[model samples]
Target: MDYLQSLRMFVKVAELGSFTGAADQLRVSSAVATRSVASLEERLDARLLQRTTRSVTLTEAGRLFLDRVRTIVDDIDDVEGGLLAATGVPSGTLRIAVQGSIGARYLAKLLSAYTERYPLVVPQVIFSDGPISLVEGRFDAALTNDTYPHPGSVVARAFAHLEMMLVASPRFVPGIHGSAPLTDVDPLVLLSHDDGTAGVEPDPVRRWLDTNAAHATHIRANNSDMLRGMAIEGMGVALVPAVLVEDDLDDGSLVQVMPETPLPSMGLSVTYGSRRNLAPNVRALVDLLIEQSKSDQLPVALRHEDAALVAGD
Candidate 1:
């Protein structure tokens, strides 16, 4: 028997003092309503209603059960109502993981606006050069490039593209000198991101180097900022995210090399545990990120252009 249905039928019948009246109000036939109440009484082994030819009334036991069941049904309604209302306004901490290079350069700018818009949401971020398990880390979502592997049970939404640019310190590769094909450079040392997390995709810079300059020496760092620093110090040429080095490029600290070589832009994606039962805060952040990526309001280094050949832009 459907216990809740039986309880509801009994309550309605008792209140209306007519089995037929309760059936009409509940949109069920009188026989089903009577059987539902009969099933309830048989299960409890207690008579809950006093029936008469003219009217129906509740017994003492029926009155007590009615009060408790009313509260139970009302509580269920309150919980459902509260959850529905919460879908519109997000609250609570929203933990996110981000790639180190993007985090250092542009994540903060995006988050500043997010905070202003959603003051109640507390955001915590984890910076990783490689992939991290979102579920294991207890992250609500992760911001990453398309090169990262998507874990099972996670859903990804691509928002923008990050261009990777080949850069060298002016002190190391001055103008008109470093513009040659990568193979022409002597004693070339390529700086790349070292693999840290399991199942990370191969670095595009390393792949480019292998095909173009098989003999170039390679230096690896687990973080992009370290690669940027090494490049700035004239240690070697590095393929760094454009967003992280916009100021350096403008200040003449770094120069873009081999501008003619076209490299595929990596897509920036947001990955969440699952689309099912997505929290309001996580949804809000993802929407904000998509909006920022499409508009001109993104960081200067992240702007997309049709003519530029560098990466990270």
Candidate 2:
């Protein structure tokens, strides 16, 4: 058995606190990861981890070993980076996980520009609606709304703040009293993402609805696009991220239901595992995202409106 490989696996298992999670991160089977850690314990003649059906805990010896191993790993990474830098071109695969709507709306432009600038660097993007675990997913970085919860192993950067709007179809708005207080709107149709209301609370729209809209009816959709489509068809009102429905609102396909009550802004953040000496590709992509985020692009709704105005002119 490769002692270094076993030690690496052991450290990963300790950091994650589960063999299964470590396996997922390492791209190996759970059984293989378990055996690797076991082999390391045998070689060291120390029971490094205390394990149970519910959880895994590191013993005193394990904690000491981890501290020493982490330093060695950091040194190795620095040496590797110095050697790689000598080759002149930064080249590697960068795996990124992003939310579906943001990826669809903005990633293409950013990715196109990035590829143009770094032809040798390849990017693989994974899109999902909910947050993904950086430690479990083995991704180089993730673009998500929720910041990572754990410390020491991750770092987060604010990418952008998304402005949201509540919109309804023209037909839906005509019957409803425009001057009526937001609380007085009848048969209020609330569109939601996913089945349950996680990360939906403490939202501006949610807070407003909780305080003012007593008779509001709730509707759930699995994705933002679905919610927007339902709202555009006059099925109900949807509090959607402005970027997602700007085109429809501008084209008269949908109308802003309450222009005054803007949904509270939420940040879009990019996070990465804070491994020593981040991969060149990951570092390059992070810098690119930061640069792109600095530009003053119009909000989605305004951009859509501008397009319509341009066509008319």
Candidate 3:
């Protein structure tokens, strides 16, 4: 048995806390990963992990070994990266996961620009709105919102700031003057993100409704696109990222209702697993994104009437 390979597998299992997850990340079968870890435990003459049908947990000895093994593995990766960098040619399949909403417009443009700059690099993008596990997914990076300052074995860099707007269908609010008081909007129905409000503390939207429009009916949907569709159907009002609804607003299907009340902006960030020496290709992509973010080209634009309303308020 290759002890080095076993060590690597053990480290992955420790980090992800699932044998199946480690197997998937390493691109190996579950049986192979199980055998590798078992072989390591036998060599050490100690039980490293306690496994249940549902989860994997590290024993005390396993925890201590994991801390040391992570350092060793990281050092080896850095050395390999240094040697690869010496070749001065960047080439790799960069696997990335992006927020589903942003993937359509902004991310598509950024990716097009990236590929043009680095023709040697091929990108595989997964679009979803769920939490991304960089190591478990074996991805080079993730472009997402919601998980800011990501925890252990991960790093996050802000890529874009997305402003949000409160909007409603023209028929629902009818000639809704921009300066109209929010209190006066009658028969309010709020379409919101499905944040599982059964037990947990209410999210910002629910809390806002509770405080400002407690009488308004609330409907929950997971996707922002769905919320936009619901609003356009004249079902209710929705507070959504401005960029996602810009075309709709321009076409007069959706109208901004409360310009004076600025919904907090959502931040987009690129995240990757923590590594001492990131590959040159990955680093280049991260740098390009950061530079683009610094230029601030993706500013949110509200309609002219809405802008005036904010100014007047």
Specify the highest-lDDT model's number. 1
lDDT of 1 by residue, 71-172 (tens): 565455345544643666878998989876664567888788889999999999888765567767889988876556654344567777777788889877
- The segments of candidate 2 whose C-alpha lies over 4 angstroms from its true place after superposition are 1-90, 147-153, 179-181, 195-214, 297-313
How do these models rank on lDDT, best leading?
1, 3, 2
lDDT of 2 by residue, 264-305 (tens): 665566777643356777767766766666655534432211
lDDT at position 60, candidate 3: 98
After superposition, the stretches of candidate 1 with alpha carbons farther than 4 Å from their true spots are 1-86, 174-176, 197-206, 303-313
What TM value does model 3 have? 0.63
User: Model 3 — which ten-residue stretch has the worst lDDT?
Assistant: 304-313
Error of 2 at 261 (Å): 1.6
TM-score of each: 0.65, 0.65, 0.63
Model 3, C-alpha of 26: deviation from truth (Å):
11
Best TM-score among the predictions, by candidate number: 1
lDDT of each: 0.73, 0.68, 0.70
Which parts of model 3 are misplaced by more than 4 Å?
1-88, 146-152, 175-184, 195-215, 299-313
lDDT of 3 by residue, 192-226 (tens): 66532245445445556567666657787767889
